[model samples]
Target: NGKEIPYDPSALRKIREHPCYSENASHKFGRMHLAVAPDCNIQCNYCIRDFDCVNENRPGVCSSVLSPEEAIVLVREVMSKDSYVKVIGSDIFPISHPSGTIVKSKDSYIKVIGIAGPGDPLANDVTFETLRMLKEEFPVPLKCLSTNGLMLPEYIDLLDEYGVSNITVTCNAIDPAIGEKIYSYVEWEGEKLHGRKAAERLLAQQMKGIEMAVEHKMAVKINTVLIPGINDHHVVDVAKKMGEMGVYTFNIIPVIPLYKFADIIPPTLSDKKAMHDACAPFVRQMRHCERCRADAIGKLGKDVQEEIYRNRGSL
Candidate 1:
């Protein structure tokens, strides 16, 4: 798995620094995901945002949505590793000291600032505002965004302009028929489409967007939700196509099984491993995805929410 880095020296350097892309770096470098975007353009059947910040660890969920200004302030605090008493919107974080005082240390420093929203970032205008503000205040941390790629092509320039070099796109299927089964609907240019139409439109944009991001020399990563009856069998195809497009990494995340797809059984660890192994031959595979929340902070295993909330009494 370590042998297939398709990127040039510069891109490989960025990948090595990224916590999510590089398993070895995750233990040392930390990343913070700001939940600033709350509106999505594409509705995947397996995704549900009914519970935004509910102490659950998963994607499409957050403690709260912050404005551009608030996001900047949060990033500043995280980078400074200051003692945060209480923060905005649901007391955003419980940091540093016990009794809700955040302990600041070198270990808690956030190296990467990203927005993997409770919704699609490209669909929300505040994403740009937040990125612009972050770029101004925090110039060091690598910037990234997670999206369904519905609006990727439209916002690629904006993302690049704001120093966003890392991108993760959730593409469940390369085939429209299979995609239709995974997504309920998609919105393009103020038009709402469903079924095969929505699937095809989203797929076309995903391919084009990945190609554009690659051509721009941005480190592109593909995140595929392995739906057993839906696209599990086709994830390898997804990886192969994305590899041909020059994507840097492929992460086959097991479906969380929620919303319209709730009744479906979640993929077993073995199933994930099988898919992971199958896709490894095509592109570099990521093995350390925590399915992080939109407001996640700290390293891969020591995130703020998981550390503070899950182990509050002990701390």
Candidate 2:
């Protein structure tokens, strides 16, 4: 029996090693997120930075922050312990540098180097510096970043320059009115903006930044938090626009009731499925997102941050 399955080479290449982007690779590939960035430029109602627990899986939650050097060491340690942690390239296994430092190769275990925040990666200068250092030192792995999109427009060029091919922007609402209810405030150029004005500004920046990322040929994924009464109804609209902008995927995550939106109920499974069905025709829907922690490590659903932290002797 012979059957030919047509495939887009570029698309296949894009999702080959990134587990977050490819459902198939999710079981085979692992990712390491460096919590180097600790400052956020915007505030979403569903986010609570004060809560930190090993069981909690959400943005803005990380066990600890590490310097660029420490982050590199952590990656090396993880790869040294596991052979499956692979980065991009043809070489198999990591080699030691002349200075006794571990040099990562194409065949290492950690395939992806992601900067996914204890906060928005673009908001902190440390994030750029860390990425630059990683780019210079370990150029084999796939570099990825996630942000709130407030500062994304200004940094899109820099990110592309640094060889960052994958970007995730959390866009809870396409409409400013709905966004206003979701985001408490946004700090732009050092000024605090509140209410509808803040939401409008954030939405504009998110859309513009997404457009720029798509123009740069970056694999863009929009993360929409589905708060039942807030932006649930507006997700289809967001997906439609994202499709128009050529975004690769849309991750519609059910809102975790917390912080300012504690009283609001999370969307039921049926409701979530209904939204995905509605938006299925517009863009690719991500049904497997774990709403991972900022310091999340290892495979998609089975996180190994605890083991890594224990082996490293600290949080």
Candidate 3:
């Protein structure tokens, strides 16, 4: 985006290097997404969180879980090489593993470290711990995080302490009636909520969380999963709301029909482009989104999703 960044010197630098946050930077900058979060609080109708498959590509799929300690080792290695390399286990290999080929780059295209989960990053304690350890060990060039915004209000302070400068929140709907249609249940505060009640709580938190994140001065981006008949009309409303809250960017993600939403077809390119154009007036729209896997590495790399989906038959 060409808009002015209101952040101080340190925060501004993080946004500049962040590929997802900055359109121009993406072509020259790479990012590394660590799939360490193990669980999620809410269950979406389209979501199927799976692990150990090593053959599926999507948001909720990963080869294996990593301990905070293990995640640190990978980050350190990526930094040393000044490039993108995927590392799995103590035995780091340059090849793509069965779980997925994890690779690191050795160039000036600096990498932004982030956690996008097979589960929600905030739902896992290890996420915070990983960021904490990273901050202490070295001067983190640009740390980012992607979450559902369910736990943002509660953990915004911790994010500040751990140095998460860029955050992406997935907000599907602002209305509970629409939300209930998208999500099955939301596990909040030790209670499993269903239907409208669940959607109500989830939307409330999402709105509040986005507001809080903006106030914290973190570069905020809103990701809305475009479900044709579901939230299609309401995507603009969500964007207008995020725009009011001072969000930096808006990403309209095309839904991959799965689980309960398997019957629905994904939006065509024209449909998606229409939605993007509609939402652009309210907030700056992301030019291109690979809608990457939780473990996908590089600058919005196209490597992971293609490999995993094509080889699922081998499993």
lDDT of 1 by residue, 80-181 (tens): 633332232323344543454433335234557888877788888999999988888777788988888888898888889999988999888999999999
Question: lDDT of all predictions, in order shown?
Answer: 0.77, 0.77, 0.74
Candidate 3: tens digits of C-alpha lDDT, residues 114-222: 7887688999899988898889985557788888888989999999888888888999998899999998999988899999999999989888888888888888888
Residue 31's lDDT within candidate 2 is: 77
Q: If both were scored by lDDT, which would come out higher, candidate 1 or candidate 2? A: 2
Tens-digit lDDT track of model 2 for 1-315: 588877453465456788878887676677788888777788888877663211124645445888878887877677564333333242222222133333443334457889987877888898888888888877878898888899889999999888898899888888898999988999987799999999999999999999999998888888887888787778899999999999888887887788888899788888888999999999988887877777778777666676557655674
| Runs with alpha carbons beyond 4 Å of true place in candidate 3 | 1-11, 51-61, 82-108, 302-315
Model 2 local distance difference test score: 0.77
Residue 156, candidate 3: Cα error in Å is 0.3
TM-score of candidate 3 versus the correct structure, residues matched by position = 0.83
- TM-score between candidate 2 and the true structure: 0.86
Model 3, 89: alpha-carbon shift in Å?
Answer: 30
**Candidate 2 local lDDT, residue 299:** 73
Ranking by lDDT: 2, 1, 3
